[model samples]
Target: MNSANGSAWDDWDDEVDLLVFGAGAAGMTAALIAHHEGLNVLVCEKTAAVGGITSTSGGTTWVPGTQLSVDAGVPDSVDDARRFLQSVVGARGGDAAREAFLQSGPLAIDELQRISDVKFVAAAAHPDYVTGPGAAFGGRALAPLPFDARVLGKDFARVRPPRKEFMGLGGMMVNRNDLGALLSPFASVGNLKRTLEVVGRYCVDRLSYPRGTQLVMGNALAARLYYSLRKRDVPVRFDAPLVELIREQGRVTGAVAGSADGSRRRIRARLGVVLATGGLTRHPVLRKQLFPVAAQPLSLSPDTHTGDGIASALAAAARLEDGGDSPGLWMPCSIRRAPDGNDHVWPHIILDRAKPGLIAVNSRGERFVNESNSYHDFVMGMLRDAGDGQSVPAHLIVDAAFIRDYGLGLLMPGRSRARIAEFERSGYLVKGDTLEQLASKLGVDAAGLARTVQAYNRDAAAGKDPAFNRGASPMSRFNGDPAQKPNPCIRPLGDGPYYAVTVWPADLACSAGLSGTANGEVLDANGAVIPGLFACGNDLASIFRGTYPGPGTTLGPAIVFGWRIAKFVAGKLDQAPAGERSRATACANQPS
Candidate 1:
């Protein structure tokens, strides 16, 4: 089966319906839908592994204005969700993208559940970014399947753990309150017991399941699809990156790829190619190109997301549409040095909303924007010039009392206290006994820092935070402890030995990508579709422009469009005239 040149002739034939480029969440989701729709599907992954960023992400897919809200007895309409998206995304997003997402999201979720191993839980407390005017309060985000990893067996080694694992507890069934309770030590006994039970059951599943069958979120989706395809003896060769798209007469006929052994082999796809390889997060060149000054050595995605699939598709004459432009971008991340001397990057920390008494500042020692705003707003403020047309790196300032009373954003209370203490001793965290002393140590202006704190404290004590308006929406529930009546997220700066950590606006990835239609069709620079090509996930222009409308926004649209592209292609194949016998045969094998 495998040639000495390292190329395996995998039943190569010109009679397949779908060719999926990446096995990430979106691609895998599409594969399941297409396969169940009676299409012959072939998925190729560049890495030795299958799951992409979804495996390493928080694993929560944010889909706003979904029917799940309706089924749950919450009143959320597609029309209302569309209005909110327009407000957040502005004119960049129009009727096409909005309509596509709303129309397909519920079906996507439902279909995945019926055919795959998905166990979704509605977000009980995570509100749409736009909550006040025509926004759902707590029904947009969907958690991943709560699966037992034992199902994966040997395959488990290939799956990447979520970069932020603490957030993935509660079997993908967690409500916002469940998540908050998980974060809080004083109020987590019940949640803790339940979490232990879930872990116990997961351990059992791993022990009893087949070596290649696992039930974790990304692994669950991947395993279920893998099992289905494997049942039919479909071949999956890993470490096989798409080298080129084989073309004939301006249509994609097949592809050539490089396998793990460094040999190239050609495979034919009679129908079409689906590129769901995800974004270029791990591609430093792309990162620096998109965000010149945000930070270096940055990436929230796993090292596997090198944008190879995107590049290969472009080379095959697939034009990428311009995606959401960068604005109000916020990384809101945590940084700690790895043992290898490189920094461990963590992005999109929602804890800023739960903890109130803290504020973020640039290197110039001044508040730049609302620390509690959406991640988009938070990062954009950091990217702004700190007056006088000079650039300023940012740092986060938190009081000792604040940390003790309310907790640091991601560093849970019990563990965070010790970690902060260690960081202080190690010089990563700066602390001093007095306001002026702390400012002096951190190389910031003592008088200005003190004045800022004084004004903030004065306003907070009066039950009014005019500077930033910390608590503005339901999303800010974790701003601070409810026990602190006045300014729950705000506290006076006098409790000496203050603290500061050099912070940067970390990004999940560049959300700005090639623009695409709702059906995941990439258009030319002139806005004309180049038939036989499609895109989804970060590789496609975001339907909500750049701003995250809610928790599952990225995953929601990616899966929807992936399905949409397959459905569209299938429909076309089914309608082809009978005279075109050879073409019809190819189309028949692809899927409909």
Candidate 2:
């Protein structure tokens, strides 16, 4: 009954009740659930590090109707969430898949919190990215509560580090709340105390470690999952990539994986295989087919996500979802090459664009969108304004006052002089004594720049943006500094020393992938289930059908479906023969 590359069953290296691929949040969650169900399980990671892009992400999950939201006094229900999804997703995604995600999301969170070390808190102040029907001011998005990486002990080294550009003070990881204290240490006694405590801890950590051990966001989520796995005694093989899936009687039964040194091992899974690889954003051919704009050199996803899961599933007759409005979730990112000859990307998620005194302009120096919009919408504006690639590299213009309070791109706030000098030296930022000079340096039209700034300043002074309405939305105000007068998202670009940073369209996640059933079974071209094969995370086609509904949309569904697939596999394992169960358990106890 063995299939795939003609690998003989006699050469099988190991066996387990379930095999999970890609060791990100989704994969790890699946493994944890399988172990909880008393099934023998194994996890395979394609890269040296287990946390895929999730480790470097914001680590927020948009799971509505959760206990955390209720405990935080935020009103949310399944009906309201369904309405929200209907308004945003329309009819693109199947009703079954969407309904399953909505129903399973809160349950997944509740179960994980009850059974594992995972903890979540409601983001009460965060608003949905778009102000549409059924959108809530809060309660929909949940973020992982900050976790202490020291809990992992020496295993902390296995956790992937956050992007260098995202950290501060030589790799000290700061959360959103701590960032405010760090930015304004003199604001109050409480602020000063918080700053001292954080800095003191960071200084102590740096004495021995390359980066601070206080994990936040994606790293915190990954660390918690890894900790849970270790506690459950789950065996995870790093640098092991799936090469082929073995089919028995038209059902997936096992897989062959290759090590970094080209050594191969066959693993027999008695129940099923779960594909949770991040997604297809880094695949060259797939990118060409999926992306609307010219292929750019930047992607926010980890390099390990190259459609491995999608390719493997499709090869086994799995179907791919079609009719997504956009094939990817995008972010506006800036690139800077370091002395090490590598290009570093900084995603402008919430730092600069919405703040006062900053404007984004196309090549002609004309504003095309509300600059205070979400990162996803900002890139959509760029794509729309990109006529023949003219706006491919849009410029974000900010004045010296803005840079001092809220740094542009990789330049941190408050320390403008030294950081700006370093940025200019690296050619990552352009500076000018006047708007005209800045336009000249950026290759934008001088007259257009002057006219645009003049009109914007007049609007800022009047506290009204008649052109784009930058400060009109709740989402915009959430990301803005409320201490400023009239409008938080609008201010006049006063005198001189204007700065410009080049921004490119970068994908944050693949919005389209292998089509699967609600329980995670891969679907064939005719919509029949490909038995024993399942997918979650970016490996599964997005439930939103390409719309960025809110923060954590990518992660929420990933966790829900991973949980669902584990439950489904557990049911199948319960029905298997005693000999099969014993053999799987025997293999699981064997040393890797």
What residue pairs are clashing in model 2?
Answer: none
Q: How many clashing pairs per prediction, in order?
A: 29, 0
Report how far residue 12 has shifted in candidate 1, in Å.
5.7
Per residue, candidate 1 scores C-alpha lDDT tens digits across 452-522 of: 78887788677566877776666654434557666555555557767776655655655656655666666
Per-residue accuracy of model 2 over 213-274 as CA lDDT, tens digit each: 98899889999999999999999998899888888657777888889899988898877889
Task: Point out where model 1 deviates above 4 Å.
Answer: 1-15, 164-235, 327-330, 338-342, 352-354, 386-392, 409-411, 415-419, 478-480, 486-488, 572-592
Worst 10 residues of 2 by lDDT: 575-584
TM-score per model over all chains: 0.84, 0.93
Best by TM-score: 2
